[model samples]
Target: MNRRMAVPEQPLLRVRNVSKIYGRSCGECMEGTGPERESNICPKCGSIVAGGPISFDVYPGEILCIVGESGSGKSTLIKSLYFDDTFSSGEVYLQNYEEGKTNLLALSSQKKRRVRNCLMGMVYQNPQLGLRLDFTSGGNNAEKLLTADWHHVGKIRERAQELLARTEIPIERMDDCPKNFSGGMQQRVQISKALANNPSLLLLDEVTTGLDVSVQARVLDLIRQIQRTLGITMIVVCHDFSVIRMLTNRTLVMKNGRVVEAGLTDQILEDPQHEYSQILINSML
Candidate 1:
């Protein structure tokens, strides 16, 4: 006789009406690279400007797909949650907010850096952007674990090699830099490094966009398998409707920086509520 295993349940993270604004008429808003151009509020209407107030929750052992087209604010949502940008209104709650948990929107700059790279890992669309082109794949992977503070350097190196093998990339080729690896191979390395510290939340931002159709399928399957085994919560940002359907249980559709439709994967696909969602479904077909 076979016995079923018990699964643990917990709320991993939450985002509550996060809003970010760039420029301001009086120069009071946060000044930075991407937020330098837009006004914080409408001078004429006094309406809140820049990033929209966005809210969402990430449950343990669940893959949440945040779907939207270009400029629909999907990227902004991720950036805000990771504290890469400042929010002008509302707050982002992490792991028990009411009990005075760590405020995602209020961490110091240095703490934010630590939280992002270690506690929450992010995989960009372009793997090269995340990897050190000058370093070998093994070296790049090892760098992520530096934050882990593993005293035995040799053991860390061995662990990095093991990761490459686990991701199906031959350990022998670990010496090759990301520039030498194909797009698909580079993506695998990125994933291995993103999982360096066994993060609870993994933000995958269109991680398989540049790969070929066959490669995309393989990467998606690998992600599914890994998530099942590790029980990591993920927020996959993608424009491709089918990709979300294949990987996620629940889906949130965004249009013009706001949630238009959200529900179970099958229900959203079978009977869409928003016109944009309908167009997305038709395109996927």
Candidate 2:
């Protein structure tokens, strides 16, 4: 299933056989013995392989899209990458930091915090996950800046203002609580909060879901503008192919927690070679 797409020699991130199983490990679970791909629950250990033996590369400054329907394990995969959940097995390497030399899963709690705050930013489908609804808009933005060790109060406020404006939130509303915002505005603030540290990687999962269609378009536009303006590497996970077409350079079509197809976004959408990917694209059309 389009197995030979080229990737940069030095990719920004590499996930090798990253796996997450809910129960105990066994030979079948370890080897990812999914006879029916749809069945991630192992008979031997009764462990559910939530995601993986999944592997892929995200190149520098590229938007990588992961698409799959419900129960396809796409959400679990991204959660594992961000350490919102841990993998039962496999290694994740951030380029310039590893070569399978150091395992991210093995990092200390403090070091892991550093990696998440300084190296990556994640925007979840639910704004509450990424934002502090109780805090003022400026306070929410300052929270991330503080996490990255920014101690200058004046500078932090200024940066927060800049980021809020960049996200299209009015500067005057910086003192308002995020809970007061409409769904779309709250999501924008979350985006601003995520971008506060200028992370090298951004993970967006079902970002456009639940918003009004018009609001969705505006958020998408802002996201595209942010990509062009900051050139941040992104991984966007969505069931909607329209979102993928607007955002990604490359894509991985997942089913039952495994990548069934990988290729240029246009190529995969236009002429999907995998049986599952073909069905997904056809349904989208």
Q: Please tell me which predicted candidate would have the highest lDDT against the true structure.
A: 2
Q: Model 2: per-residue lDDT, tens digit, 36-125?
A: 545677767788777778888888778999998787788898877888888888888887565535778789888878888888889999
* RMSD (Å) of each candidate, 1 decimal: 5.5, 3.0
lDDT values of the candidates?
A: 0.75, 0.86
- Which predicted model would earn the best TM-score? 2
C-alpha-based local distance difference test score of model 1? 0.75
Quote each prediction's TM-score: 0.85, 0.93
The per-residue C-alpha lDDT of model 1 at residue 143 equals 88
* Candidate 1 Cα deviation (angstroms), residue 21: 2.7
